[model samples]
Target chain A: MVNLTLIIALPLLMAFTMPIFKMLNSKLPKFIALLTTAFNLIVLSSNFTEIMAAPLILELGGWQAPFAINLYVGPLALVAAFLINGSAFILSIYNLSQDYQFDDKFYLLFLMITAGASGMVMTGDLFNLFVFIEITSIAAYSLTTFAGGSSYEASFKYLIIGGVGSVFLLLGIGFTYSAVGSLNLAEIAASAGLINPLLLQITALLFLIGIGIEAELFPLNFWVPDIYTEAPTAVSGIMSGAVSAAGIYALARIFFTLFPAQQFFNYLLVIGVITLIMGELIAYQQENIKRMLAYSSLAQMGLIVTVISLGTEAAVKAGLFQLINHSILKVLLFISAGVLISAAGSKKIKDLAGLGTKKPTAAFGFTIAAMGILGVPFLNGFISKFMIISSSLNADQFLITFLILAAALIEIAYYLKVVQKLYFEDLEIEVKNTAVITVPVILLTLLIIGLGVYPQLIAEPLEKAAAEILNNSRYIMTVLGGI
Target chain B: MLNFLEEWSFFGGSILLIFIGLYGVLSRKNMIKILISLGLMDTGVNLLLVALGYVEAANAPIINSVNPSNAAAFVDPIPQALVLTSIVIGTAVLALGLALVMKIYDKYSTLNISEIRGLKW
Candidate 1:
């Protein structure tokens, strides 16, 4: 019996004791981060089969579900945890090669963010979710300032927005507690039908405004591009790939389980579509490569949210698949682009011209990931894209389908522009010795192609997770009934 | 009237504090003031949470020699626990924000947030 609590606890324990490790050996924190994430992945996989068979609910302090905090590792949560830990693991590998000024603090924050994100996914309590969200956000705010210049401003912007959003989230929690007299997610879901309509509406809106900021929904995502652009590459990779996945999981849990209402789904649909179009359009105009990728990441987030908001099992599965693909592909893109940026000593897309020959591995990484995102055949993204299209069509949402396709076209144009600059254009700047990130690149690439070729590899878990997310009664019964 | 004061006053005052903090957050130009406003907002939310768990004529949720067995007379303790956690989280965030604001001050040599447009939002 692998205790799932270790997934969060080990990282947090390591993170706080990181300075002690640093005191003992100057070279210990990065490897510690890597080992922690690797162990987390191992722990998650060890419990995978059992959790797939039945969701594991761990009651803290020997108290029952309604009265105590619990960790619910449903199929959906298990998949999300895998994605979160998987990203942290890959980024830890990337971090091993790079050094920061206060690297011990960096690794500390890094581990905490991973722990916080995993906690967000597995937690069965709403207040616990808020705590995890705050943990992730605080770590992120500190992590962004590592770049040391404009990064402070970026971090400040993110801090202000995140602070306000958290306040709203607390208000929502208060409303939920006042109404339901409980904070357990399953308990709330079971009696959620009894919440007064007006208070429900207000609480839902407060939650939307709160979680939407973290989930990168439209209008609430203004702080995203700057933070992604200014933060170190590994930080950007984890934030885009891991933390946002947790955000979406929280959103899905709230809207689907705690308050499954047609009205909220409609609100999400509109917000997701708007976020998608806005992200793509803004990405089209970015001059900086990281900022471009940031906007593209935002668009991908919007795309995932839209697909899942369709409320069909197939659509949810497709959304989750796209989410998995986006995490893998974006991490690859950011790492490769980070290399390219350092090699060129500039962030402009034009300056990166003709690096294809100078930096073959990184160029190849960027190209393959870009192509994967653009939905080229035989890549993981292609299957998810196909699923999204077909699922939306099945839902008979023609206008949404058109908007999504249009966003894809915009995505293809910008990504191809960067790729063309990499290979086809003349060399505009001399290259420097870039970090050797070949290992992570190669690993992510293989996974992308492997999943692309064998789409059925994750078919069962994705289907089960989709069904688990859609059925609130199953969640309520599993958590409360198990008591 | 006393019942109204007990119920509406706590709720209304905290909500008003939240709005006032929000207004300060939006209307203030200085970065420190903005952070202070954020603190106010956090306090307001904390207050509101405590108020939500408030029960009329109830005591603090403590077990003493005299009130050892009476659980129903006690106000809810969950929100108070939540408020404590929230306060800690809020303090950490505020401190981090203030540290960043100091760094921004060092770089831009000004306290005005509008002037620190190194990266345009």
Candidate 2:
């Protein structure tokens, strides 16, 4: 069996040794980072069968559960770790083609962020989760300022908001520990029934607010657009793909395993609806391409949150499916947008006119991504949207079903506007297409279409992931067996 | 009043500190002051975590030759460990925030956050 600890250790070891590689050659760090992520991807894939068979619990320092920190690698965590490592590998390849200052620091921060995200998903302790969150945010904050213009301002704003969010998260962990007298998530959940109802409510709300900031839920997500727009496009892609997915995983794990309150689900549903409407409506007005894509990403996340909030088996399954689709689509959209923006020398939608003719492949990739996000038929998004809508109806949530469909219409409208602009507008400037950028975009586009045509390929795994998420008793038993 | 103070002081005081820090973050325009407030809030959280693990009249969580076996007399070590990690993280964030503030000052020539609106909705 592959040592699951190496999944996090390898990237971190590479990140700390980045300075040595930098001293050897200015161009060596990126390759080393790429190799590390590729290695991590290989290790993770080789352990897929083991993860699917049973949750792998690694007890650090040779201590048993409830006494020492542990890593609970379940199917849900494996799915997220795979996404993080896979996206990092692809993004590293994309990074190799770009020329930027501070190359060494960039790769170092990138690897650290990837490692931190993996730690966040796999950690079995609440305090460990907070530590991993801080690691991810700190690395992300540094990466945001890599461009050294408005990026500094964006990173500062992110630091402030993220700092506040971490405080809340710490407070929630403190409260949970005080109540349950254990820091282990499984132990806390096992003893959750004994906690005071009012205290549980307070802790739940604290966690919701804390993790919601990272998850890009409605009120706390104002930092999304500015950070996404101002940060380097590769950073923006990772932020949208791996970082946001980790945030969603954290939220789902905490809510489902620790505090499965019906009232909280109602709160999640209402907030998700509002976020969906707000994100789409706001995205329609954005003149900048990255900001538009960022808002659209937020709206998709809101839709997923709504599905998961339904708390049904089918709903959670559909939510995970959408999560995977959104990760792939955002990566394609953002990286392609990076290519297009560099080609046009401006991010304004008007400035990008006629690039469809200049770079047809990238333009087509963008169009397909836009269509997939809008849930057009024969797309991966459509399958997930169909599942969520039908599940809502099955749950007899008529008003929610109506609201969701309404949000879908608004989503389609904005995406159509972008697609029309991409293909139908008059050519204003010529664009230079490069192979490095075009290849990843096309590869992700193919993955989207492939999944769309054959949804059954991921159906069984996603079903098991959803089951792993919903079965709190199994999680508890797996982690704290007969303790 | 004494009983109330004794019972609620640590938790209440930490909550008050957190609010004060939040108010500073929202109300203060100076970038350095905002970061200072963030540090204050982190300190408050650390104190709260340590307080949560307090046992009445318990000793520090050290096992010595004299008192090696009585676990109940020692304060919980987990929260202390958590606080230690949190404090290190807090320091790193504070340092990073300060570095960003320095850069923002260098670019804008002012520490007022209201003036740093280079990118907006």
Prediction 2 global C-alpha lDDT: 0.88
- Writing each residue's lDDT as its tens digit, candidate 1 over A225-248 gives 999999999999999999999999
| Positional deviation of residue A94's Cα in model 1 after best superposition, in angstroms | 0.9
- TM-scores for chain A over all candidates: 0.99, 0.98
How far out, in Å, is residue A159 in model 2?
0.5
- Give the proportion of true interface contacts each model preserves, from 0 to 1: 0.90, 0.90
> Once model 2 is optimally superposed onto the true structure by TM-score, how far is the C-alpha of residue A426 displaced, in angstroms?
2.0
**TM value for model 1:** 0.99
RMSD of 2: 1.7
What are the lDDT scores of the predictions, listed in order?
Answer: 0.92, 0.88
Model 1 CA deviation exceeding 4 Å by range: B118-121
Off by over 4 Å in 2: A430-435, B1-7, B65-72, B118-121
True contacts kept of 1: 0.90
The per-model DockQ list reads 0.80, 0.78
Clashes of each: 0, 0
